[model samples]
Target: MANYLLIAASSDIGGATARRLRDGGHHVITTARDASVIDPDVVLDATDFDAVDRVVAEAGDLDGIAVFAGSMLLKPAHLISRAQYDETIAASLTTSFAVVRAAGKHLRNGGSVVLSSSAVALAGLSNHDAIAAAKAGVIGLALSAAASYASHGLRVNAVAPGLVQTRLTEGLTSSDMSRKVSEAMHPLGRLGEPEDIARAVEFLLDPANDWITGQVLGVDGGLGALRPRQRV
Candidate 1:
């Protein structure tokens, strides 16, 4: 079994990933900001670099680390408040940077690191300006970290997922009409499930995929590559 550390384990994707890894005979150490909702091995905000370092120090000899911390804010660029922008960036890009930096320093040689991105970052979508920018920053962080740590045999990569059906997206997909619209927006004609992204994350975390590094694998249900079908 391989040892792994997961930051922000309270999210739907993080929880699903933890279960998948554990079921695969891997040991996972989880961290969460809210200890009440999800009991984690470590209770610390990943946005704090010092806290990330402390958690990784305690997680010792980890083979992989995945940062699943992120926030979704659907607002036009002109309407996004300063507070909203700050919060979104802190939740997405800032936390990602902290996790990747700490992992580069703490993870054992030949270990892997996985960060989260979004399909909106790769392809523009309406009212997603704030989130798109932040997630794009995550892609940059992953690529830079991968280059910085490659000599040590460490690999860093990212997963860019489309509209996954999770608590994070419940507000956008709760109603029947809204759900239909979301599904139609994807070329697959269905919204992505948390498990789908979880599986992609697992692949990157697997030590056997050591050759893959500095790549942003899109697990976006073909949304990133194909446009939505045109109405007749």
Candidate 2:
């Protein structure tokens, strides 16, 4: 069985991805900021480069790495404080950067790397300025890393999800009215499930799909690409 490292395995996407990878007969090593009920194999903050590198080194060589560590901030651009803005970037964009950097140095040649982006990066939405900017940075980072690692046969890609029902978005989906609005915003008429994003990550990490790289796969429920019918 091939070995893989999943950073932020405590999150919804991370937890689901771990189960999927393990059930596929692969060895999965998980990391999170703390060892809570999720029971991560390793506990380290993804934003800390030294901590990330140390844990990755200890995981030994990995066939692939999936970085699913991030948080969501839902507020008007004017309402968000400067400190909160920095926190958003640290949690979402910087964390992804750290994972890719560590993976670049430690992953076995020809290994694949997958990171998370968001549907907001592709389509504009009110109160998503902070997150949209961060996810957009993730896309750029993944593409550049893909080029830098291409000579080593290493592949890098990203998955941009739309309104997934995870802890990160519970606030937005908790109420019936809000949930309905969210569902309506997507062409699929529903918010995404953690498994939806997990499956996309699984596909990108598969060695059989080695020919694919440097691509951002939108796993959103057509929220980023489609428009609802309007009376003409």
For each candidate in turn, the TM-score is: 0.97, 0.96
What is the per-residue lDDT of model 2 for residues 1-232, given as tens digits with 9 covering 90 to 100? 8889998889999999999999999999998888875888888889998888888788887889999977778888899999989998988889988988888888757799999999899999988988888999999999999999988888999999999998878888999999988988888788999999999999999988998899999999898888979423
Model 1, global lDDT: 0.91
How accurate locally is residue 202 in candidate 1, as Cα lDDT from 0 to 100?
A: 95
Clashing pairs in 2: none
Residues 87-154 of candidate 1: C-alpha lDDT, one tens digit per residue: 99999899989888788788757799899999999887999999999999999999998999999999
After superposing all C-alphas onto the true structure, candidate 1 shows an RMSD in angstroms of 1.1
Pairs in clash, predicted candidate 1: none
Clashes of each: 0, 0
- lDDT (Cα, 0-100) at 128 in candidate 2: 90
